[model samples]
Every structure is written in C-alpha cells, then in structure tokens.
Target: MLDIQSLRRDLAGVAERLASRGFMLDKAEFSRLEIERKLLQTHTQTLQAQRNSSSKQIGAAKARGEDVSAIMAEIAGLGDALTAAETALQALQTELDALLMGIPNLPHESVAVGLSEDDNREISRVGLPRVFDFPVRDHVDLGEKFGLDFETASKIAGARFSLLRGDLARLHRALAQFMLDTHIVNHAYTEVYVPYLVNAESMRGTGQLPKFEDDLFHVPRKDMEKLYLIPTAEVPLTNIVREQIVPREQLPLKFVAHTPCFRSEAGAYGRDTRGMIRQHQFDKVELVQLVEPKDSYATLEALTAHAEAILQALQLPYRKMALCTRDLGFSAAKTYDLEVWLPAQNTYREISSCSNFEAFQTRRMLARFRGENGKPELLHSVNGSGLAVGRTLVAILENHQQADGSVVIPEVLRPYMGGLSALRPATD
Candidate 1:
C-alpha cells in the first residue's frame, strides 16, 4: 500500500509515475472520493463535538435542579445525527483503502523507464552457453529416457504435471536440498518450515490478494474463510513478521524455506506447455530478507548474489537483467531476473527473480522495527527464488545431456544424490 500522505500531498505526481507502468490511475475518481471522505470526516467530528457540548448542557441543567427533559430530548436527536455521520465516514474510509490496495508500488528512481521486458537492461552474463556436439534435447526428451513420466502425471492430475522416478526424482529433490543448505549455511538465512495453505490476510500482506485472485488456488471452507495455496515460499517466509514490531537488534532478518509452490497459471496458457518449465506444481527454495530501510538496497544486491551463487555452484551459464519499470512485479520497487541458459532453446530462461520491495510489503503487513529514535518504522523486504527447483532441473538436464541419453549431475549435488555422478537410461 502507498503512503496515503504521499497520495494526499501529490496525487498527480503519483498518478504520472503509475502511468509509466501502463496503469491508469483514476484521478477523477480518487479526487472525488477524497473530497467526500474529508467532508464526511469533518461532519462527523462536528457532530461529535456538538453531542459532547449538548451532554454538558444537560448535566448542568440537572445539577441546577431545573427540568432536564428538554435537554435530554435534544441530546437524543443529536445522537442520531452523529451515528449516521460516523457510519458514513467509516464506509468512505473502507472505499479509500480498497482503492489504495489495488495500486502497484511505485518503481524506484534507479529503475529504467520502459514499458516491457524488451526494454530491460542486462547487467552481466556469467559463463558462456556450451556448444553441444550432438543435437540438443529439451528437459522432457532427456528425462523421458531415464525417469521423467509425463503421461502418468497427466493421467493422475491433468496437464502441466510431471512424475519423476529413480535418479530423475532424486535429482529434483537434490536440487532443492542443495539450495536450502547453501542459503542457510553460506547466506546466513534461517531455515523455516511454514504452512503451505495460508489465510487471505497472509496473501494480502504479501500483495497477492485483492488483485491476483484469479491466478491463485483457494479453498473455501465451511466457515466461509478461504485459504490460498502459496504461489511461492516467498509469501510465507516474508510474512513471518506480519503485524510485528521487531527490536532494533534484529534489524536484518533473513529466512529461507524449501516448499512446494502451486499456481493456477490462469493467464499463462499454451506457453512452455511441453515441459516442466511451466508446471502447475513445482518445488522452490525461497529467500526472504527483512532489513532496516537504510540497509535494504545493499541487502538486495547481496540477496541477488546469493541466488547467483547457486547457479554458479551448479556451473550453469546465466545472465542478470534489471527489470524495467513496467516489467517490475506488482509489489517490487525494483527487480533483477536471473535467466539461465537452456541448451535446447538456445536462449536463456528466467530461473530466479530478486526484488527489493522497499516498504511496500511492510506497509501492508504492518511489519516494522523500533529505530534508534525509539519510534517504530517500516522494514524493507527483499526476496527471490534462490533458484526455482524445476527450472534449475531443466537447465541441468538440457545443458548436461550426453549422447547416450544420460544426464551428468552437477558436482555439488552429487552428495545429496547418494554420491551418484549421473543419470542413465535403464535397459530392458
């Protein structure tokens, strides 16, 4: 949520920034609502003062032993008017809140001013895409020879699902474990276990609700409250401090979680439909940091590097790109996407997105820290897919495939895969 004070002070400036991101702010509507809210609040305050003054008058009349019936009747009439004014004021406030909640976060000044992914600036590329001696196969074809079973997965759960067996399944699990261990040990992030199903308030705190409902999977309970499936572990990990006020000593809180993520893919139709690249369900090792505002930008760089470290450890070729203003996520002030090379596609695909949300998420979550001045202030949030497990799996399969339909496991993941070095096909 934007600071209402900023909007009140300069709605035009805020709206203009929003326009750069292709979001048209309803200026006329906002102005109208603001005017009405101010009027209603003023009217309510006046009525409240009037009611208090009338009660005092009635008290004096009773104290003087004079007939107080007339005064009592006047106070009753004032009570009715005050109640109506207060109710109207409350309703208008709710409307204003809803409007504010839907607005995306303003991009940071450093973000490039552009309208799409094409305008995103490349920061740097690490490791070159290997030249394959044989015709490259995508993850699907490479995994099928070993353990990737799509037909069975589809039969059980419909499209955009896959079942891996033997080494392939172990490799997938190993990827997640490797990421979690690296983040916890090397990155100084506390590993947490969170619920996969969260309440609507949790979703709202993380900027996932009231806008992207269609893209979420929700369960309606008998009590009528809906629990939403997490689209990423970032939601749960970052929200750990929701509605909390941390002591200054805990200025920087980093957390990591390895969890299964589910997305409805409501808007993603017919894209990457052939492989695990766009699965409905996938595993991820998420990284989240809550830091004092002063340290947030530096933390974002460190956080992005931590994710890049995973790709480097796996020896995967990847590049970092700074997302343009319009290409930034709804809650992010700035974002960096790490696109890993895919040998089959002969191009890079996004494996992780690191973002500095500034105080956008903290404002909504009411997550704050007491500062040196003894006042509570919002904490800035940073998070990223330390590496999307499925996509990393895809990168490994496609980039490490051998001519005999075998996939060589990365050296770091071998420890988690029972010291096995590669995945090979089974002979009948």
Candidate 2:
C-alpha cells in the first residue's frame, strides 16, 4: 500500500511512475472521492460534537430540576441525521481504502525507468558457466533417466508437478537445507518457520491479494471467506510485526524461512511447461527483512549479495539484473532478479528475485518501529528467494551432467548429501 498523504500530495507524480509498470492511477476520481470523504468526515464529527453538547445541556437542565423534555426531543431529532451521516462517512472511507490498496508503489528514483524484463540492466554476472563436452540435456530429459517422473506426477496431481526418486529427491531436500543454514548462520538472518497458509489480510500485506488472486491457491473457509496457502514464506515471515511498534534498536530485522511455496500459475500455463521451473508447489528458502526506511536501499544491496553468496558457494554461474520500473512487482519500489545460467535451456532464468519494497508493505501490515524521536513510523520490507530449490536443482542437473549419464553434485552439497559425488542411474 502507498502512503495516502503522498498520493494526496503528489498524485500525478506517483501515477507517472506506476505507468511504467502498467498501473494507472485514477487521479481525478481518487481526488473527488477523497474530497467527499473529507467533507463527510468533517460533517459527521460536527454532528457528533453537537450531540455531545446537547447531552451536556440536558444533564445541566436535569440537575437544575427544570423541564428537559424539549432538549430530549431535539437530541432525538439529531439522531436520525447523525446515523445517516455516520453511515455515509464510513462508506466513503471504505471506498478510499479500496482505491488506495489497488494502487502500485511508486518506483524509487534509482530504479531504471524501463518497461520490461528485456530492458532490465545487467548489474553483474558472477561465476562462469561450466564447459560441456557433449550435447546438454534439459532437466526434464535428465530427470527421466533417473526416476524423476513427470508423467505420474501429472496423472496424480496434474501438470507442472514432479516426483523425484532416490538421490534426486534427497538432493532437492539437501539444497533447501543448505540454503536455509547459509542464510541464517553466515548472513545474520534468523531462521524461522512460518505458516504454509495465511489469511487474505496477510496476502494483502505482502501485496498479493486484492489484485493477484489468480496467481494464488485460495482455500475456502466458513464465515469470513479468509484465504489460505501461502505463495511464499515472505507473507507470514514479514507479517510477524504487523501492527507492531519495535524499538529503533531492532530496526534491521532479518528472517529466513524454508517453506513450500505454492502458486496456481494461472497466467503461466503455456510457459515453462516442462520440468520443475513452473510448479503449483515447490520448495523455497526465502529471505525477508524489516528495516528503517533510511536503511532500505543499502539493505537491498546487502540482501542481494547474501543471496549471491549461495550461488558462489555452489559454484553456479548467475547474473544480477536491475529490474526496470515496468518490471517491478506491485509491492516493490525497486527490484533485482538473480538469473542463473541453465546449460540445457541455453539461457539465464530467474532463480531468485530480491526487492526493496520500501514502506509499501509496512503500511499495509501496520509494521512500524518507534524511532529515536519516539514516534511510530512505517518500516521498509524486503524479500527474496535465497534461491528457488527446483530451479537450482534444474541448473545443477543440466550444468553438471556427464556424458556417462551421471550427475555430479556440486562440491558445497557434498557434505549435505553424505559426501556422494555423483548420482548414477539406479537399477530396478
């Protein structure tokens, strides 16, 4: 959510930045509704004040042992009007909130003002792609040889699902465990276990609900219609401080959670149809941070580097892209996407996405910190895929495959996998 004051103060400027992301703010309509809301609010308060004053007069008259019936009648007359005004005022406020929630965050000044991923600037490419001796097979082809079955997974659970057997399945688990440990131990992030399911309000806090429902798996509940199934741990982890006021000393709060990320992939039906790149459910070790607004940008760089360290340790080749404004998500003021090289696909694909949401999410979550000055202020939020487990596995399979049909495990994963160097085809 955006700061309503900023929207009211510089609506046009905010709209222009959002335009790059294909979100257009209805400035005139918002302004008109806001004006109506203000007028109704003021009128309601005035009527309330009048009612209070009349009540005091009635008390005074009764104390004097004089007739208070006429004053009582006047107060009764004000009741109907007061009720109507109060109802209208509440309705206007609700409308304003809905409008504000739909608006995307304004891009930071440092964010590139471009329209799409293709226009994103490449900040750096770390590690070099390993040279291959033979024709490289994609993860899908390689998995088929090693009992990574998609056909059975699809028949059982529908498309974009995979079932790994023996070493491959265990390797995936090892990857997530390693990633989570690295972020928590070496990077100063506190490990957390968050809810796999969250309410709609939780989704909205992370900028996923009101507009992007199609991309989520919503579980129905009785009474309130609250949704469930978290798309990422970012939802639950960052919302921990929702409606909280932490001390300034706790300004930079870092959290990492290894959880199963669920996505409906509604609009992504035809894309990445093969392999685990696009799935309804996948393992992800996510990183989240809550910090003072002043430290957000610097924190973004540090956070991105923290994610990069995983790739470095694993010796995976990856590149960082400074996402263009148009490429930024609804909740992010600025974003960096870490794309890892996939030898089979012969291209770099997103393995991680780190973003600085500034105070966009903090406002919605009501996450604030008590400043040194002792005033409550919205804290900035940042989250990233420490790395996507399935994709990292895909990159590993394709990049490290030998001509002999064995997959060489990355050196860093050796200890986690009980020092096994390679995965060979298992005999029935």
Candidate 3:
C-alpha cells in the first residue's frame, strides 16, 4: 500500500505517476473520505473532552452538595455520540485502506516511460540463435516423441495441463534441481522449503490478494479460512519476513526455493495454450532478497545476474529487457525480464522476471529492519524466477534439438542426469 502521508502531501502527483501505469485514482472520493474522517475524528475528540469536563463538574458539584443529574446526563449523551463517531471513523479508515491496497506501486524514476511491452527497452542480448539444418519444431512437436502427453493430462484433469514421462519427465526434474543447486551454491542464497498453500495474509503481503484473487486458485475449508495456492514461490519466500523486524546485522536476507506454482490463468485464455509455455501447474526456482533501501537496486542487478548464470551455463541464448512503467508488476517499482530465445517460435520468450519492489511489498507486509537510528524501517524486496523449469526445458528442447530428434543436454546438467549428455526417444 502507498504511504497515505504521501498521498496527503501530493495526491495529484501520485495520481499522475499511477496514470503512467494505467491506474486512474479517484481523487474526489479520497478527498471526501479524508474530509469526513477528519470531521468525525475531531467531533469524537470534542465529545470525549466535553464528557471529561462534565464528569469533573459533576464530581465538584457533588462535593458542594449540589444536584449533578443534568451534568451526568450531558456526559452520558456525549459518550454515546463519541461511540458513534469512532465507529464511523473506523469504517471510513477501512474504506481508505481498501482503495490504497488496490493501487499499484509508482514506477521508479529510472523506469522507462511507455504504455506496453513494445515500449520495453532491451538491455542486452546473449548468445546467438543456433542455425538449424531443418525445420525448427516447437516444444510440443519435439516433446511428443519423448513422452510429453497433453491428451492423457486433459483426460485426467483438463486443458492447460501436461504429463511428462520417460526422459522428458527426468529432464524437467533435472532443470529444477539444477537451477536450485546453482542458486544455492553460486549465488549464496539460502535454500528454503515453503508451503505451496498459504494463508490470505500471506497472499496479501506479497500483493497477490484482494486485487488479483481471480488469478489465483484457493482451497475452501469448512468453517475455516480458505488457503490460496501460491502463484509463485516468490510469495512464501518474500513473505518469510512478513510482520517481522530483522536485527540490523541481518540487513539482507536471501532465499531460494523450487516449487510447483499454480495459477488460474484467468486473463490469459487462449495464450500459449499449445505447450508448457503457460500451464496451470509449472515448476520454478524462485529467488528472493530483503535488503536495506540503499542496496535494493544493486541487489536487483546481482539477482538478475544470478538468474542469467543458469541460462549462460546451459548455453541458452537469451536477452534482458527493462519493463516499461506500464508493464511493471503491481508491486514492483522496477523489473527486468529475461527472455530466452526459442528457435521454434522465432522469438524470445520470458523465462524469468527479476524485480526490485523497493518498499512496496515490505510496506504491505510490515517487514522491517532496524535502521542506523535504531528505528524500525521498511525493508526493500527483490525477487525473480531463477528460471521457470518448464520453460527452461522448452528452451533446451528447441535450442539444442538435433535433426535426428535427439536433444543435447548442457554440460552443467550432465551430472544431474547421471553423466548423460543427451536425451533421445525410446524409438531412437
């Protein structure tokens, strides 16, 4: 949530910044609520003061042997009025909070000003797309030979599901394991195992609830709060510090986790429906960091490099993109998307997104660290998909595919694959 004080200071400026991200702030409603809140609060305070004054007079009159019935009655009326005003004030405050919660984070000054993905700036491109000797096949076509079964998956579940068997299934697992080990060893992130299902507060802390609830899958409980399936490991990893005040010594906390993420894909109907590019269930090795404000931007770059290391190690061609203001995620002040080259698609597809949320998420979580002045201060959060495992598998299959229908495994993953260097179909 945005600092209400900032809005109070300059609602128009805040509104303009949000407009760049396509959110129209209802300033009139906010102003009305603010005015009403102030009036009610002042009236409540006045009532309390009057009640106290009357009570004092009643006591003094009793001591003087004078009737205090009128003063007592006046105080009783003031007390009732105060109760009503306080209740109304609380309700208005709740309304203001809901409005603030729905607002997206303001883009950082460094973020590019644009209106869509087209306006995103390319930071760098790594490796060249391989020259193919024959027709390039998408992951769906190549995967069918090695046991990628969408038909069986749909029969058992529904659409947008996939079941991998044999070498393809093993390769999928290897990708996630490799990414996890790489982050833990190379990037020095503490490996974590978190619940795939989290509470609503956990969702809200990570900016996933209330607004994007439609994009989530939830498990209903009888007479209990429903739990939400995390859309990314980023939720649990980042929320580890929720409602916490870390010791100053632990200024920065880095975490990595490999987990199966579930999303409803509510708004992405008919998009990437052919293969593993978009799935209701996908595996991702997520990286999250909580750091002091001064180090957040620097941490973002380092975190992005940590994700890039996996692609570079696998010899996959990819590019880094700086998302425009309009393309930034709800809670991210700035973001970098790493799009891996897909030969079959003849384009780069997002395989990872590294973001610096600044204090946007921490503020919502009330995740804080002690400052130099020994005061609790909000920590800045950074997170990224070290690599989406399914997409990484897709990239490897397409980029390293051979004319003979065999896929060459990267050297880094050979050990994880029991020294095997390539995946070939059983028919081969």
Candidate 4:
C-alpha cells in the first residue's frame, strides 16, 4: 500500500505517476472522499470535546450541591451524534484503504518510462545459443522419447498438468535440488521450507490479493477462512516477517525455498499451452530478501546476479531485461527478467524475474526493522525465481539435446542425478 501521507500531500503528482503505468487515478472520487473524511473526523472531535467539558461542569455542580440534570442531559444528547460521527469516520477510512490497496506501486525514478514489453531494455546477454546439426526439438518432443507423459498427467489432473517418468522426472527433481543448494551454499541464503497453502492475509501482504484474486486457487472450508494455494514460494518466504519488527542487527534476511507453485492462469489462457512452459502446478526455487530501505536497489542487482549464476552454472544462454514501467509487476517498483534461450523456439523465454519491491510490500505487511533513532521503519523486499524449476528443465532439455534424441545433463546437476550424464530413451 502507498503511504497515505504521500497521497494526501501530493495527490496530483501521485496520480500523474500512476497514469504513466496506465492506471487512471480517480482524482474526483479521492478528493470527495478526503473531504468527507475530514468533515466527519472534525465533527467527531468537536462532539467529544463538548462531552468532556459538560461532564466537568456536571461534576462541579454536584460538588456544590446543585442539580446537574441539565448538564447531564446536554452530555447525553451529544452521545448519539458522537457515535454516528465516529461510525462514519470508520467507514470513510475503510473506503480510503480499499482504494489505496488497489493502486499499483509507483515506478522508481530509474525505471524506464514505456508502455510494454517491447520497450524493456536489455541489460546483457550471457553465453551463446547452442548450434544443433540435427533438427531442434522443443522440450515436449525431446522429453517424450525419455518420459514426458502429458496424456497420463491430464488424466490424473487436467490440462496444464504434466507427469514426468523415469529419467525425465529425475532431471526435473535434480534441477530444483541444484537451485536450492546453489542459493543456500554459494549465495548465502538460508534455506526455508514453507506451507504450500496460505491465508488471504499472507496473499495480501505480498500484493497478490484484492486485485489478482482470480489468478489464485482458493480452498474454501466449512466455518474457516478461505486459504489459497501459493502461486510461488515468494509469497510465503517474503511474508515470514509480516507484522513483525526485526532487530537492527537482522537487517538483511535472505531466504530461499524450493516449493511447488500453483496458479490458475486466469488471464493466460491459450498461451504456452503446449508444454511445461505454462502449468497449473510447477516447482520453483524462490529467493527473497528483506533489507534496509537504502540498500534495496543494490540488493536487487545482486539478487538478479544470483539468479543469473544459476543459468551460468547450467551453461544456458540467457539475457537480462529491465522491465519497462508498464511491464513491471504490481508490487515491484523495478524488475529484471532473465530470459533463457530456447533452441527450438529460436528465441529467449523468461525463466526468472528479479524485483525490488522497495517498501511497497513491507507497507502492506507491516514488516519493519528498528532504525538508528529507535523507531521502527519499513524494510524493502526483494525476490526472484532463483530459477523456475519447470522452465529450467525445459531449457535444459531443448538446449542440451543430442542427435540421438538424448538430453545431456548439465555438469552441476550431475551430482544430484547420481552422476548421470544424459537422459536417453527407455526400452520397453
């Protein structure tokens, strides 16, 4: 949520910034609401003061052995009006909160001012797309020879589901394991295991609810609050400090989690439906960091590099992109998307997104740390897919495919795969 003070102080300036991201600020509505709020609050305060003064007069009259009936009656009459005013003030604040919660975070000054993905700036490219003498196959075709079984997965679940058997399944698991180990050991992130299902408050803390509710898989229970299947481990890992104020020494808390993510893909219908590129359930190793506000932008670059390190270790060619203002995620003030090369598609596809949400998420979560002045201040949040396991698996299969329909395992992942070098077709 935006700082209400910022909005109150410069509604026009905030509105203009929001307009750059294509959000039309309802200036008239906000102004009208602000007026109503001020009036109700003032009226309530006046009534309260009158009640206090009249009660004091009533007390003095009683002490003097005089009838206090009139003074008492005056105080009594103010009671109903005060109650109504207070109620109105509460309702106005609620409305204001709802409006604030729905607004996207303002873009950082460094973010490029553009309207779409096409305008995103490419930061750098690493490695080179492999040259294949034989015909290139997408992950689906390459995995089919080994064990990518979609028909069976669909029967068990439905569309946007996948089942890997034999070596292919091992490769998928190995990718996730490799990512978790890399972040924990080399990147110095503490490994965490979090719940796959979370409450609505957790969702809202990460800026996933109230706006993207349709994109979530909600589980309704009898006489219990509805729970949501996590769309990414980012939601759980980042919310670990929600409503908390950490000590100053614990300024930068880096955490990583390998978890299965669920998404309804509400707005992604008919896109990337052919393979594991888009799935209802996918495994991902997520990275999250909580840091002092001033250091967040620097941490974002380092976080992006940590994710890039995974791709480098896997020997995959990829490019880093600075997302344009319009392409930025709802909670992120700035974002960098790492797109790995796909040999078959002849193009790069996003496998990870590193973002600096600044204090946008912390404000909503009330995640803070003690400052030098002995006051609690909001912490900035940074997170990314160290690598989306499923997509990374796809990239490896397509990028490392041999002429004989075999997929060579990346060297680093070999340890997790028990020194297995390649995935070959299984004989019946």
- List TM-score per model, in order: 0.96, 0.97, 0.95, 0.96
Which stretches of candidate 2 lie above 4 Å from their native place? 60-66
> Candidate 1, residue 319: CA error in Å?
0.4
Model 3: lDDT of residue 21: 88
Residue pairs with backbone atoms closer than 3 Å in model 1 (clashes): none
Instruction: Compose the digit string of candidate 1's lDDT tens values, residues 1-428.
Output: 88988999999999999888778999999999999999999999998988888888878988998898887876767877888999999999999999999999999999999978999999999998998788888888888887899999999999999899988888999999999999999989999999999998989999998899998988889978879999999888878999999998976999999999999998789798898999889999999999999999999999999999999999999999999998999999999999999988989999999999999999999999998899999999999999999999999999888988888999999999999999888877
**Which stretch of 10 consecutive residues in model 3 shows the poorest summed lDDT?**
71-80
Candidate 3 Cα RMSD (Å): 2.4
The most accurate candidate by TM-score is 2
**Tens digits of per-residue lDDT for model 2, 10-54:** 888878878878887898999899899889989999999999999
How do the residues 1-428 of candidate 4 rate in per-residue lDDT, one tens digit apiece? 88888989999999999888878889899989999999988889999898888888888999999999877776766888888888999999999889989999999998999988899999999998988899999899988888899999999999999999888888888988899998999999999999999999999999998899999999999999989999999999989999999998977999999999999999899799899999999999999999999999999999999999999999999999999989988998999999999999999999999999999999999999999999999999999999999999999999998998888998999998899999887766
Flag regions of model 4 displaced more than 4 Å.
49-71
* Residue lDDT tens for model 3, 77-162: 67667888889888988998899999999999999999899999999999999999899888999999999999999999899889
Q: In angstroms, give how far residue 89 of model 4 lies from its true place.
A: 1.4
Location of the lowest summed lDDT over 10 successive residues in candidate 2? 219-228
lDDT of each: 0.92, 0.89, 0.93, 0.93
